[model samples]
Target: MVYIAGEEMTHYATELFVDQWIKPYFDISTWETYDLSCKSRDVTDDKVLHDAVEAGARIGAIFKEPTITPSTVQVKEMGLSKAFGSPNGAMRKGWNGITISRDTIHIKGIELGYKNQVLFERHAVGGEYGAGYNEVGAGTLLTTYLPDDNSPPFVVDKRDLTDDNNVVVVYHNPYDNVKELAHIFFGRCLEHKVTPYIVTKKTVFKWQEGFWSTMKEIFEKDYKDTFLKEGLLERSGNELTHLISDAATMQLIRWTDGGFGMAAHNYDGDMLTDQIAQVHRSPGFITSNLVGKSDDGSLIKEFEASHGTVSDLWNDHLAGKETSLNPLGLVEAMIGAMQHAAMLDVEKHPDDASKLEVKMKVLNFTETLREAMHNTFRYGQGTRDMSGPSGFSTEDFIGKVAWRLNR
Candidate 1:
């Protein structure tokens, strides 16, 4: 497994949780570790980021701490090299990523905003995140796609710019990987027994029609029969469905008990999943896992918390003030990574009895710890964020979970 560390208070919390929660039961000495702090990236010229992504691809399981993508202001404050881009894009591309899955974390006996699980699969590449744009005076704007075979270059878009202040942005959705994404997304819905939906703005943007059409074609050919047999279609009016991005947004709020899965193009998915995270009470109550394929077609996965580095809490901690930062997201992400590593081990060594035993031990430990954490919150003992003002402090919450585990 690969463990990539980050900056800020989240990094501090990660070290504390791993020391108190994981080290006592698990031996992680063999895990590959990388420091991806802002200072470290500046010192290493961001080579450490690339190296970490490569190691994650090689190892197949990664647990990453949320890191900062320094803006111009942050770059000056940090007092080091140029502003670095987010490591997420590089990591996803390096791993040949298909979809990024974010699901609500349902803790029993705790009533969150949602009563059921809402799973979101975001197409991991090729949209506005990589778009090219430029501002110019009045002129004709032309975009073309050149075929590598040199048959001809075709115009993608052509528009006359009438205003002096105008910006033209262009991007493409890669259809080649949509088939792979469909397989993963629908397959996930079937596995979780949730109704599947594909969201797009085909009516408004004709270019987005390609994405919707591709997903529909793949779903009809590959997953329709299985979904029907599993009674998943019953949840969506007896057929697989497509929802416009706007409609999907409204439905998310109306369907409080979420027994559905949704897949959207990169930008829409990015925005919609944030809403899902909020509906689940907080980003702290969600787990993010990027699922991809390796060069050999094996599975590659990286897990992390759905939230940011919580810089505000870090500042408070720095001032020697008591902070009650919630660590649920990070804790769950670590458990997920450990579980994935154990499963991969079992898959690679199916006939090895020792490997199977080790996998079981990991399962038992994760289950026990998960229940302990949940019980701590259920019984009115957690950080002030989850519980009330009378709730435990950050360290106290962890100590409570530890106490439960020891018993």
Candidate 2:
């Protein structure tokens, strides 16, 4: 496992971050540690960053800290006009008022290899944007946004399977784009001998839940023979079965336990992924991929960290306060990318086999991560709130992992 601490963290800080936060749990005497502090980057003319990225690519996973510095409050205090010599000017305009240049760090999926990847896309919905949920009363906003009248008609495209590789699409909405993608994925999976499953609350929704029911019908009719031939179809033991959603969840647990491959729908997949991560005792240890199916039915895969940026803890770190933010999600993203790369390599050169090695590396990565967290909490060195019997400082937790990796 490799960790790239950006310009913000000094070598001393990085070392302390690792030793105090990471080392106690992990024995990192044999593993490699590269400190890419600003000084080192300046001395090496930024080659170090590139080297570290490449190294991470070669390995299966790498963890990175937020490197892009936020605009200083001092700049705002000085006045944007005075600072930039403009009477009326926009200081920052973009997502979150931060323009993250692509050159800063080669983000996975965006710049690197993301083609033909299977990604997990998860997001919250309906809670803040449904009937009686928004700022305005539900009935008050009949037509939500302007230009609603100009919107085009909804189109559903039913076409023959084109891609040879199997795909699985899962989502909640009846009109979700994921349904279309799921069709493509399932068809491809059939062609490639991969199994696909869809879990939905159709039992309760009935006609109101036409989406999943429609999908289930299409899948069963279109691929019944193929599924049977592949030994994917089998009657449940009991004469009376449970609801589809329940069956789907049970199937997923069974498949995962049996080491069989399967794809999941959005909400269920998201919940299942979390379950798996927790079962493994590391949400940060999991990698998520997002995929888009092309017109030709090919796939475009995008990889991202399953976890969000620890924004709350980030502020404390900036203020030089203690934090217990876990970077497992980010680390798992790196591992996922590495696994993809390794699979590609194996496909290209089956003679020089390294698949097992790659798998071992991934295992080591997670083991070290878990050990570190355990050690931090065990020693009562984590964040204060997390310290009662289970919590530890962010650095201390990570330090345990680093220590284990070194060992």
Q: CA lDDT of each candidate?
A: 0.88, 0.42
What are the clash counts of all predictions, listed in order? 0, 41
**What is the per-residue lDDT of model 1 for residues 97-206, given as tens digits with 9 covering 90 to 100?**
88888888888978887887788889998899889999899989988889999988999779999999998888877778888888888888888888999899988977
For model 2, residues 211-325, the per-residue Cα lDDT tens digits are 4455566666676677677754444221112236567555544443231223333455556556555433344445554433223332223234454444556566789887655
Lowest-sum lDDT 10-residue window in model 1 = 382-391
> lDDT score of model 1?
0.88
Which candidate number has the best lDDT? 1
TM-score for each model:
0.96, 0.41
Q: Which ten residues in a row have the lowest lDDT in candidate 2?
A: 94-103
Off by over 4 Å in 2: 1-287, 292-301, 352-390
What candidate 1 gets wrong by more than 4 Å, as runs, is none
